[model samples]
Target: MRRIAPDHDQLLAIVAEVFREHGYEGASLALIGEATGLGKGSLYHFFPGGKEEMARAVIAHIDGWFEDNVFAPLRDGADPSAGIEQMLAVTDSYFRSGRRVCLIGAFALDDSRNLFAGQISNYFGRWITHLADALVRGRHRPAEAMELAEETVAAIQGALTLARAADDAGVFSRMLRRLRMRLGLPAKT
Candidate 1:
């Protein structure tokens, strides 16, 4: 029987999950092959640069996700609070309520970060920019918007760590609530 290859998106999703779960140094070809049901040669055929290439592909996927789910809504004049809330709700599910590691955070945990510094930096930079724009739309001045955006990102990353360490999602959930307030979103009735 002829072997059928996984498509780029499918293969990358599998590889990206491995990186997210294990970090770059820990995501070996053997593990990736097992996930993709591909042999070493087959996996190599898709990503010639190996783990470095795979990490890059994962970053690309993350960028697209944020483009659609994060930036687009903010730019389209959607209510920033609702858009942000929806995004976090999906994030709550995606990360299993802050139990799963962030792929960007995972990449930063290993030496492989050197291979994809630009992608990682762009990912975070875009987040802050879009978030700050939304804050400005919410009536914050540009300077405060930028500052609040950075603080929101820090709170999010920190909340994830605290949630994981405490083995509870409440920490993350609370941070999201606080983030909503920081945007000057009206309190929920």
Candidate 2:
């Protein structure tokens, strides 16, 4: 059967959702097809490497999301603390206020990691570096900023797991709140 070409963003959105719902090795082409509304051939037209390629696409998509929503705001100079609050708001919104798990964390364990460990490591490293830069701009010592940034990322990832396990989104919310307090960020509206 002939297949239709899919929009890049639309395809990635569907792929990300499927991966988020099911881990890499567990993500079936049938399930991905169901999500993308694309037949096998159509899916291949976008991701010639199939699931792994789809995962690469998601990593790229999330990197862009971070650049625009998280990293960009973190570096905004007018009011970095406000920038931080906005970043937190965007993050909380992206995870549906903790109702959903982090896509990066989802890939961190199991067979998914086997395929994308480097990409996942780069993703988190970029996050920590940018966050550390922001903290330094806030007048923290370089060493302390790096440490804080690492802890902040760790806390956020951990909160996602704890919230999911506890079936309470507030766990994630509190984690963000604590990070903000630690960084002396103005309360998010």
Q: What are the TM-scores, per candidate, against the unseen true structure?
A: 0.89, 0.92
Candidate 2 wrongly placed segments (more than 4 Å): 1-6
Note the Cα lDDT for every prediction shown: 0.80, 0.85
Model 2 C-alpha lDDT per residue in residues 1-189, reported as the tens digit of each score? 765656898789878888888788778999999887888988888889988988988988998888888887877646666666777788899988889878888888666787888888988898788888888888899999999999988998899999999999999999998998887776666
For model 1, the local distance difference test gives: 0.80
1-189: candidate 1 lDDT, tens digit per residue: 876778989888888888877778888899998888899888778878877888888889878987887777776756876666665666667667777777886676578777888888888888889888877877889999899888988788888888988988888888877776766776655
Clashes within 3 Å, all models in order: 0, 0
C-alpha root-mean-square deviation, each candidate: 2.0, 2.0
- Return the top candidate by TM-score: 2
Point to the candidate with the largest lDDT: 2
lDDT of 1 at 104: 86
Stretches of candidate 1 exceeding 4 Å from the true structure? 1-4
